[model samples]
Target: MSLRALPILFLFAAALTLTPISGLAAVGLAVGIAPPATVVETPPPPPPPPANVWAPGYWAWDGTKYVWVPGSYVVAPFPGAVWVAGHWVRGGHGWGWHDGHWR
Candidate 1:
């Protein structure tokens, strides 16, 4: 490479090596950088009937594209309880799913 291009090439190489994980903060920092907020398209269908407490659907990574999974009615863990909405959480390298549950 030409001398002028050598430094530019080195900068690009360093950038690649320094790229941080999606939720990671600065290197060696325990705090994680919050992921960019996601815009959910076509919100999950309305929760199932009262009998099946509705669990809000969330975006899930499916290898190639983000897919929406329809929410379903679930039997409450106990009577007179409510269902907590599901959410996506940051894991070590990627996002993980926290399923809805009775609260």
Candidate 2:
């Protein structure tokens, strides 16, 4: 591998691979390859407290191929914020990721 690419690889290998920060989503994650289709998931039953919102899963590029991230419920950031699930968008370079956030 080229020396320039070494650091990028090291970052993924050292830390958690393909995983986004908890609650916070990645703003601009561009990848050369396109991600696979999103998996179809039947959301599990909501917990007793209706405070939590369901965040649907999407394909995550792990510096390589796509990986499936299952869906789950998350507590709202604030009183009335809605969960905006992450998604993939096509751009000139390739597919890019727009992570979910509270509205």
Candidate 3:
């Protein structure tokens, strides 16, 4: 290739790499590499309640982001009550976490 054409080739390569492409409906694309993994942190235990069962804290999925809801004791949702721990689930190429509940 002649010197005059070298600059054009370089510009074309740059444009190709810089172009953006959308990925999954719930996720977006990154050029040349996948996105970094999200680190999930375990929350501290809730303060002791008056003769109440303890509920584990977990991350909750908001429409466009994740929010943390603190755990607390409350009246049982049903006659017989139990606490279910919250967990993060893999969805749409990302993690969708469900908050804990006391029932």
Best by TM-score: 2
Structure candidate 3, residue pairs in collision: none
Off by over 4 Å in 1: 1-50
Worst 10 residues of 3 by lDDT: 26-35
lDDT against true structure, model 3: 0.54
Model 3, position 63: C-alpha lDDT score = 47
Candidate 2 local Cα displacement, residue 34, angstroms: 2.1
Q: Candidate 2: minimum summed lDDT over ten consecutive residues — where?
A: 20-29
Give per-residue CA lDDT, model 1, range 1-103, as digits (tens): 6899999999999999887664443223221334345544453566455566655555654445566666556777667789877666766866555656677
lDDT of 2 by residue, 25-89 (tens): 44566788877777888877645367878788888876667889898888887888889888889
**TM-scores, one per candidate:** 0.43, 0.67, 0.37
After superposing candidate 2, which stretches have Cα over 4 Å from the reference? 1-28, 46-48
lDDT of 3 by residue, 1-103 (tens): 8999999999999998876543233243212222234445454456545456656444444444555666555555665678777666655655544545665
Against the unseen true structure, what C-alpha lDDT does each candidate score?
0.60, 0.79, 0.54
Candidate 1 versus the native: TM-score? 0.43
